[model samples]
Structure formats: structure tokens, C-alpha cells
Target: MSLKYIDLFAGAGGLSEGFIRAGFEPIAHVEMNGDACDTLKTRTAFHYLNEKNQIEEYYNYLKGKITRNELWAKIPDNLINAVINTEISAETLPTIFEKIDSVLGKDKVDLVIGGPPCQAYSVAGRARDPKGMTEDPRNHLYKYYVEFLKRYKPKMFVFENVPGILSANNGGYLELIFEAVKEAGYELDKKVLNAKHFDVLQDRKRVIIIGWKKNLKLKYPHFEENEPQYEILKDLFSDLPKIKNGQGEWGAVDYAKETNNYLEKSGIRNGVCFTSQHIARPNNPNDLEIYKIAVNKWVQDNKRLNYAELPERLIKHNNTKSFTNRFQVVNHKGISHTVVAHICADGHYYIHPDIKQNRSITVREAARIQSFPDDYFFEKSRTTAFKQIGNAVPVLMAEGIANKIKEMIK
Candidate 1:
């Protein structure tokens, strides 16, 4: 039988996707956001259909030929019920337990994986709050995660978080978390892992803590870094059609060029000729000019344009002392910066490298940067999609971790 695992705080199943690709069976996915839940359900349906050789039903849904409800009808009820969509909290603990138990049956959870919302432990969150978000309710979520470890007693667990977590509350919070995990009868190891080292196109660093039952004698798996051999633009983006601001569709659109080795090998383009969510956001004239200037400076001079240095007329914000380097054009010659949830607010920080496009990277572009496959459908509006993509683990990075874990377990 396949190893079974539960994904707590699963955000659109990025980490879970990697595990699934490594042949683990997902017994349950617990999350809070309704839209993210819908996305989880959609992905669950896709996997079920794929297993049964009925992937055509999934393609039909992507092609706008069938409704999501119609597609779910093709999957087993147990498979669909496995996605538990409520928040993980003291108030919802019992109810969440009941939901997870319903699907668990006689199966033993082999692994538990997830990261709590990292906003409380992020540097940006600290800058915004007077107390550095130390008192934020999210800061205490590790207690709930410990509770899951106590309940499941899985052979192993993977805890992911931002690097700032080590410094949160002057590091007391992280210490307490480690104590809790140890007290639960497990030995743990943590390392700061970079997504780029795992073959992800962007540079994303996170705190990865792996814990195993004391009797298992497993230590942290050695993750070998596999750097990209191709340029970010040539391998990751050159094939997508160049649409102007506010141009392109949210659904399936034609690929600008044929698939390349990286696209196929990483499964980013996978069996699809046409891709979805390749649309660009509409930008105003002032922002457009600023975007062009930023792109030109980056592409031509290889220097970032300072927002405070823009022509006086184009400067809108009064506080010019900080955030001057806000507008960043994605570099064509290299990988992108970390894709963050902030992209949902504005594209100023994520301007496209293509001078002609002259806009922030689109929904699909952001997803590709995160290493999601072309056929991975994100439910809801483009803004919500960006949030999900930004908040997710790069599919490739997650898969690398999962593959190593599988080897360790075997």
C-alpha cells in the first residue's frame, strides 16, 4: 500500500502535489480559505480522474466544456471528501478531527506535512506591526500544529516556515515550538533550504524542519542542489504569447512557441498544447510609463530604477525615503525573485522583463515562475489566483523534498 499522509494548512496543495507525484496517498487535506478549498477539490478531482484513465473529463473542465460539479461527479465521494476546508483552531479542533477521522478509517498516517500562516513570523509583517506581530494570534498557531503531531503520531512530519521564524519573539517562540515537538516523542532536524537549490526557477528560502518518531532512526535527508542550466526567459517564459496590459484571457490560450526541454521535463507544460490563466492586468498610463522606464533600465543598463528618482510628475507617493526600489522588472537572464502574496495588491514589484509587454507579470507567468504545471487550474478570480500561487511552495521544490523523503522512508 502507498504511504498515507495528511496536509494541514495545505495551501492549494503545492507541498502535497510534490508528495503525490512521489506516490504518496493523501488521506486528508485541511485548510481554511474557501477559494483554496475549491482549488483543492478541483485538484483532487483531477488526480482521481487521472488514476482512472478518465483525464479527458479533467481536460474538458479546463477547456470550458464542463462544469466543476460535472467533473467531480466522475470522482469517488471518498476522494472528494478528503479535502477538509475549515480553519485549524482551538474552536474548530474537534470538528476538524471528526472530518479527518471520517476519511482516515484503518489507515495509519505515515507523514504529516504543512506550514502555518507565516505572516506572523515574516520580516515584512514585523515592519508593519509595532510588536513585530509577536502577539498576533497566528504566532501561537504552532501549538495547534503540535496538537496534530500528538494526535496522529505519524512516523514522520515536515514542518515548513519562513526564515524569520527563527528570530520571531527574539527566538523564544521557535525554541518553545521545538520543545513541544520533542516532548511529543520525536527527534527533529531543521535546515534553511532554498528553492533554487531544488531546481525551482526562483530564489525562495524557507525553514524546513523534519521530525520522526524516536524509534525510526531517521535523520534529515540530504537534499542535493540541482541548479538550472537554462536562462529564466528562454526556458520559463519565451514561449508565452506577449500580450499588452489587460490583454489575454483567464482560460485556455495558445502557446507562443513550442514546448522546450525544461518545460516538458519539469511538467510545467506537460501534455497540454494550450495553457490557462495567461492574462495580464490592466495598468494606468502613469504606471505604464513607469513600467517602461523600469524595464528599460533593467534590460538596457542592468540597473534597477528607483521609484523616488522617477520624473517628478510620475512620483505619486510622498514618503520617498523608503521603498524607493519598489518597482522591479523581472530579469530575463536569470531566475525571478520570490513570488509573494503582495503581488495581489499591485504589479509594481513584479514588472515583466519583456520591454514590449510593459506590465506586471500575469497570473500564468507568476504560476510558471512558481513551477506549477500549465494544466494546473487555479479556481476563482485572477487576484485570488495570484495570492494562492504566491503563497504556495514551488511545485518542483516540493517534489524534490518529497522524493528524498520517500527514499528515506523506504
Candidate 2:
């Protein structure tokens, strides 16, 4: 029988993609974002649930209250364009659970994998509330995940999140996760894995909490201590055409020829810094001065730029003006700094090793570094696309975990 799995909080199907590549058959995915749901529908056979209204029995309850035409009207036109569209309302959690139960029945599911939104516990957040102690009510979503695990009783699960959870309230939140899993009748082992140790060219470190139902006797796989012999940014992106920052799309090139020409005229050959309204320099005097001069000059001169012309949806950098100051150049020959969600908006630190342009990383380029295949289509809005890519478990990293799961199941 084929290994079966379900992905919850599946954003852009990154975890799904990893599982698929590792030979698991993905049956269903639950994602709240419409654009991400569209991306999932386009790529896989899995059902995309978008229903946002409460209906006791989705099939029977939604009957005459809204006609087919009326129900269609309720969905956004952009959402209608998605391949496997359905409405999934937050209030309809009980209905969703029923539907999922009906779908799985008594059949065995090999795995249940996901990383719920951890922004509430993220170190990047401004409040710095210790881990596990989230002021945001949304932090309780973990309880829902545990409930799902108990109901499904999958052979294994992989819960991922930021490293802050370890030290958050001095490991209180991490302990809560352990207790919850234990209560659910699973043996859990937690480890912080660096993406660089795998084949990922970026140096991102994330916590992977692996839990196995106690009845299944399985040992955690030991990660190799030796780094891969050959890993570099150029290796990841060599085939694509070299356009200055913000120039190329997958098979579609948005060449800013005039901008390139202007840069050539100005003796600035590296690349044009893609300007963004959302990006502000840190409060530091020197950083502020540099950013102000750069922004003023770029705006005043009408400098040709690659991604600068894109709408606000394509870019959202940290509000701090000194973000650039904190940026440390990655040794091009070595692994890059951790690819974070914010990297999508601010490419200040992710500059090309060979190019001089200071533009943010392109969505495709970032995806490539994250080990997504070239054919994998990302949604149009740049920021959302980047968030999906940055927040994903590296495909290779997921593959490693999946392979281990495969061994235990056999």
C-alpha cells in the first residue's frame, strides 16, 4: 500500500512538496490562505478546503440556503480561478473534522505533518514575550494540532518551528509541547537542525519535533556531522539567465532594459537596488544616512531598477532603518545566512556574490535556494510567495526525515 499523509496549515505546499518528493502520496491539505490554496490546487490532486461559513453538514446543510450561483458569488473571482476550490470557514472546525474523519475512516495514515504559524512565538516579533507565553490568543492553535493528532493517530508526525521555543520562558513552552505529545500517547524527540548541514545553501536553523506513537518502536535517525563537499549559491542558480536584481521570472523575463541602460551609463554595472516603500533604514545614524542618500538619489535620478517597479505586494522589509547594518555578507563560497521570511522583502544581506546590485532576492531564486524544483509555480504576489518559500522546510531536509520514517514503517 502507498504511504499516505495529510498536511495541515499547508502554506504553498512546501512541506507537501517535500513529502511527495520523498515518495509519500499526499491525500489532503488544509490551508487558510486563498492564494496558497490556489497554488496547492494547481500542483497536486489533494483537495483544497476554502469554505469559511459554518454549515453543519457541508453537503446537505449548504443546499437551498445558497444556490449554486449564489454560493459561487460568495467566493472571490480570483479564488474561482483556482483548480480545486472549496469554502472552509474557521467556525466550521467541527464540520471539517467530520469531513476528515469520513475521508480517512479506519484506514491507516503514515504521517501527519505541519508547522503552524509561529509568529506569535517568533524571535523576530517586537514584543519579545518569552516563548510559550503568547499574549496572542492565537498561540492556543497548538491545542488544535494535538487534537488532530489524537483523532488521526498517524504513525508519526513532524512539528516544526523557530529555535526560540527552546529558550522561550526558559523552555516552558517547549516543555508544554512535550507534555501535550506525551498525553497524546507518542514518544517525542526534538532537535534543532541547521539547513546548511543538509544540502541547503542557506544557514537556516529550525526546530524539528518528531513524535511516534508509542506502539511503534522506532529510533531517531542520527544526522551526519560532516557537511556536504560541494555547496554554493552559484551551484543552486547556475542554469537561469543572469538578470540584475528583480529581472527574471520562470520562463517569462521582465527585462528592465532602460534601467539596465541607465545603470550602464552611470558606471554602476553591479545591479540596480530594487527600491521599496516598505523598507526603512534602522535608527543608527550611519545606516540612516546611507539609506537616505541611496533612496534620495535613486528616486531623484529615476534610476532604472529591476524589482523597484513592482507593487507593494511584492515587497515588505523590516521597518527598522538599520536592518542593513545587522546584515552580514555571506561567504559566497560557503553556506548563506538562514533564509528567513523577511529575506523575501529585504535582499540587502542576500546580495549576489559576483554582482554589486543590492536588490532583494527574487522569488524564484529564493525558492531554488530552498530546493524547490524549477517547475513548481509560485503565486503571483511576491511577498506571499516569498513567505511561503522562506517559511518552508527545505525539500532536502524534509526528504531526510521522510526517508527515516520510511525505514521505521518497513
Candidate 3:
């Protein structure tokens, strides 16, 4: 029998994509974000909640709103046949249970997989509040995940998040999650996975918590070590038409030349670079004029300077704790760093090497690095697009996990 799954907190359907590839049919998905829900609807044939406010009328309402054009235009035809959207929350587990009961009625879902928002435990966020408190309210949501597991009791589940959750407060949160899983009558195994090992060029590390009903005697699968080398920026994006900063085939644009130059000088090439404001000049302007001048002056003053000779002035300027510090470049040669939501605001870590500008990485390029196929349409607007990409699990990584899950299920 084909396995069936229900995805909670499904962001851009990364987890669902993996499950689908692994041969599990996605019956229902619950997400709060409208754009993400739209993307999900476009990609799969699963029943979805309507855009309406009322819960009972959601499915009917969506039937009218989801036309072939709207759905097909946003998602590839291959992935559109298996999605259902439910606008619900983990807090409303009873309602979700009722919906599932109506559809599947006595049939147990084979798998449940989700990654709740990690902002509370993210390493990139401020570690402490003004009172020097370390606790973030968002940290408590993991309990909700456990509650859902208790209510639905899927045969298996996967919980994903950043590595910081493992060592946060010296493993307190990790311990809490483990205890909750134990209490839920599931045998749990946790591992930190690097995306590069699973065909992602970027070096993103995430923690995956896998659990199955206590009666299963299956062992946790090991992540295979694969060859590190793969296609680089030149290989992946060489064929696409070049769009200068603030320009793209799908209404995407390029950054200023100055921004591009900065990234190029820093050894960044290919992929998108983000900028805070798109000040329309005759050309893309590098906003860091003063910093660039200072670096040049320092370099000129020391004629004997080598790569090591570049003064700390440039380093300080680059590392300054300001909005400009957000200027980042995503290197095309290796795996990308984690795609974060704030990446669009500044390119601190995501600059492009080819361009001589200080622009942030674009949503499309970010999605590409995350192993999203080129044809996966994103809702318009850079911010929304970036959020979708950032929140998505790397599709390739998900495929690898799916393969493992399939083996275990069989």
C-alpha cells in the first residue's frame, strides 16, 4: 500500500517534496502563510483550505479560487497532482484530526514530517534579552509538535531544525525534545546532517530528529558520505541569460555595479546579491563608497602589502555591526551557507563573485542553491520569494531523507 502523509507547518513544501519523491502521497498540508499555501496548491493536487476565513467552507472555497492557470502557472505540472492545503495550526489539533478522520477514517497516516519555526532557537538571533535572559518564548512551540504527535499518532515522523538547537543552553532544549518524544511512545534518533553530503553545494548543517512507533525494530539509517565535488556556479547558471543587478527573466533585477564590484573583489561570483534599497541610479551604485575608498587608501599606503597585508581597516569596515554588514556573497564554487530570511535585506554573507557590486543574493539564485529546480515558480516580490527559499529544505537533501524513509517503511 502507498504511504500517506500529513505535513504540518509546511513551508514551500520542501519536506513534502521529499516525501513525494520517496513514494508517500501527501494527503493534507497545513500552513499559515498565504503565498506558501499558493505555492503548495500550484505544485500538488492535495485538498487545500480555501482563502476564506471560515474553516468549514475552506475546501469548497479553494475549489473556486484554484483555477488551472493560477495553479499551473505557479508550479511545475509534474508536482501539481498531489497537494491538499488546510489553513490550520498545531494548536487546533482536534479540528485537524476531525478533517483527517473524515478523509482517511480509521486509516493511520504513515508519516508526519515538519520543521516548526526556529527563530527562538536560531544561533543568528540575539542570544540574550536586556535582562540577560536566555529563554525565548518561541522555544516552547516544540511542545506543540509533541502534542500533535500524541493526538494524530502517525507511524513515523521527522523533526528538522538548525544545529544550535542541539547545543542550545548546553543541550537543554534537545533533551526536552527527546523526553517529549519518549513520552509520546516513539523511539527517537537524532543526527546533524550537512547538506553538501547530499548533493547540495552549500554547506548547511541541520538537525533531523527521526522517530517511529515503539514497536518497530528498525535501526536509524546512517547518512552516506558522497563525493564533495559537483557543478559550480559556472555549471548551474552558465546557460541562463545574464541579468544585471535589478534584472531577471521573471521580473528579477540586478544590484548596482559598485555592489557587484565589491562582491567580485571579495572573490564572490554568480548567484544573487541583495540590497536594502533599490535606489534607481543610471547604474547600480556601490553604497559602500567611503569604505571602498578607505580600503584602497590603506592598500595604497602599504606598497609591500600582500593578501595578508590588507589592513584591518577593511576587515573592520566589512565586519561592522550595521545594516551594511548584511552585504554577503554566495560563492558559486562550493556549497552555499544556510539561506536565511534576512538575506534579501543585506548581502553580508551572500554576495555574487561575478559582479562588481554590493548587492544581496536574489530569491531565484538562493532557491537554485537550495536545489530547487529552475521551473519552480515563486510568488512575485523579492521578499516573499526569499522567504520561500529560505524556509524550504534543500530538495536534494529531502530526496536523500526520503530514500531512507522509504527503505525503513518497506
Candidate 4:
């Protein structure tokens, strides 16, 4: 039997997707964003359809070969039953818990996995609103997570967050988090892991807190010495079709005829591809020149050009030393810096490696680096899509953790 799990604060279902890939059945996904909720439903519907051996029907819909109604007609009933679009809080917690109980009575949930909004504990968020972060109600959102753990009493639970949590509120938040997990009767183990170590193409670090009943005596999974090597942007993205600045491609974009190991493992099979969401934003002339210089310096000159090194024509400010490395050039052959939610604001920190592109990385390329499979679609506007991708846990990194959890449980 597949282990059952529920995802809370499930933005675009990244963690849930990885867990599901590791053989866990998703009971439900709880998220507050309307676009993300729609994505959840669509993805869940696709999964249910796939489970019923009807993925071809869904794929046909994605390729525009069938009507939306026709696609839904093939989706299993369980699809609609699995996504809950609501905010979890003290006020709505009881009703939500009651419904979960009703739907899953006597069926024990094996795990509960989620990361509450991390803005209150994220470095960028703290930098942006030094005082507002501490005062933000989101700081205590984990209490709702704790409440679920207390009520569900799942065999195990996974709490993920930005590394800023380690020092948020002078580390008091971390202490309280551990205390809450302990009070709920679970032994907890935590470590800060870099996604690069798990074959994710970005140098993203996240703190994962795994908790389980004391009686189970489960040990956290150790990093495998033989795990896949760190991936570079070129390895993950070179197969994707290129889009120029301000270019957007709907429907299907063609993939290279040749398949690489990463592409194959990521579910991008060798065939005519129907990838979506590969939209690139138009860079202003000023930013475009900056991107060109950055990419040229990184690729041709073998250096990262700082603001001070730029020609006076491209220099916009007097204080060049402060934000020297503001325009980051991604080395195609090297792993990327962390992809963050701020990417939605401006792509200055994530310029595409190819100088000819003259723009920041596209939504699809960002998703690729984050280990989201080509088939996994991000619904809504470019802003929402980028935010969802940037904020997501690298799916493969989550998968590695999920696999270890499954092994211990089994």
C-alpha cells in the first residue's frame, strides 16, 4: 500500500510532487493562492488520470488536440477531491481537520509535509522589511502546522524552511519550533542541505526538519557519497528551445532530438515535446545592455563584471562598489546561485548565459534549474509562475529526502 500524505501551505505542490514521485499518495493539498490552487487541481487531475491509465487523454488536452471539457471527462473523480483552496488558521483549522477526518477516517496519514510561508524568516524578506517581518503574523503560522501535527499524529512529518530560520529573532524562532515538535511527542532531526548535492542545478540551501514518533527510532537519511554530481545550467537547460528577449511560446516547443541523462531522468522523453510556460520578459534597452555585458564577461572574458567595471554609459549610480555584483552572470557550465522569489521583481541576478539572448532566464529555464519536469506546468501570469518556481523546493532534492523517509518507514 502506498503511504498517504497531506501537503499544507502547498505552493504549487512542489514538495507534494516529489513525495508523490517517491510512492506516497497525496490525500490533499492546502494552498491559499488562486492560481496555485488551479495548478494543484490540474496537476492532481493529471495524476489521477495517469493512475487510471488515461494520461494520453490528458496529454492530448495539453497538446491542444482535445477540448477542455473532453479532458475533464477523462479525469478520474478523485482529482477534484484532492485539492483544498483555503488558508489554514486558528479560525478555519477545525473545519478543515474535521473534513480530513471525515474523508480519511481510520486511514492513518503516514506523513504531513510543508513549509509555512518563509517570508518572516527569509533573508531577503527580512532585509526588505526589517521590523515588519518580526511583526508579520506569518511568523507564527507554524503554530497552525503544529496544530495539525498534534491532531493528525502522523507517523512522520517534514518541515522545510529557508536557512534564515536558524537566526530569525535571534534564533528564538528555531527554539520554539523545536519545542513545539517535541511537545507533540516526536523526536526531531534537522540539517541544512544544499540542492546541488542532490543533483539540483542550483546552489540553493534549505533547512529540513524531519520529525517522527520516538518509538519508531527513525534516523535521518545520510547524504550518499555516490549521489549524482552537481548539475550545471547548460546540462539542465541546453536541451530547451531558445527564446529571444521578450519572446513567448505557447503550446508545444520542440526539444532536441538527442536526450541527456538529466533530461531523461526529469521526464523529458525523446520525442516531439509539448512544453509550455517558456515565456521570457522583454528587457529594457538599459538592462539589455547590462545583461549583454554581464554574459559576455562571464562567457568570453571568464569574469563576472561588476557595476564599477561597466562603461560609464551603462553605469546608473555613483556607488558602484556597494552593489558591485548586482548583475550576476550565470555560467552555463557551472551551477547557478540560488533562485529566489525576488527573481519575479527583476532578473538582474539571474541573467541568461547566452549573450545573444540579452535577457534574464525565462520561466521555463528557471523551472528546469529547480528540477521541475517539463511536463509540470505552472499556471497563470509570468509573475506568478516565476514566483511559484523560485519559491519551490527543488523537486529532486525533495525526492531524495522522500525516498529516505519511505525506506525508514517501510
For all predicted structures, in order, the TM-scores are 0.98, 0.70, 0.74, 0.93
TM-score of 1: 0.98
Q: How high is the lDDT of residue 294 in model 3? A: 30
Better of 1 and 4 by TM-score: 1
- For candidate 1, write residues 230-312 as lDDT tens digits: 66789999899989999988877889899999898888987678998898889999999999999989999999999889999
Q: What is the C-alpha lDDT profile of model 3 across 1-410, one tens digit per residue?
A: 88987787788887787677667877677776778877777545322311223322322222344454643544334334333344444456677666666666666778888887777667665354542225666676678778767877877888898887876667888899899888999998999998888777678889999999899977678899785564445554443344445544443224333323322321223243322212111223443433233333333452211322334544434434444423334555555667777664554455544444323445556776777754354554566767787878887788899889888987
| lDDT measured at residue 36 in model 1 versus the true structure, 0 to 100 | 86
Which segments of model 1 are wrong by more than 4 Å?
none
Error of 2 at 285 (Å): 20
* Shift in Å, residue 179, candidate 1: 0.3
Clashes of 3: 64
Residue 360, model 3, lDDT: 45
lDDT score for candidate 1 against the true structure: 0.89
Model 3 regions lying over 4 Å from their true place:
45-91, 126-135, 251-284, 288-325, 356-359
State the lDDT of candidate 4 residue by residue for 1-410, as single tens digits.
89998899999888888999899998778888888887787787678777888777767766778865666566555456567778998888987887677667678899999999899998778888958488989999888999988888899999999999998999889899889888989999889988877787778889999999989988787876334454555467766677788896755566644668877766544243567777788888988988888888888888987889888988887887787988997768778889988888888988988776678888888888888877777776788888988888888888989999998888
Instruction: Find the candidate with the highest lDDT and give its number.
Output: 1
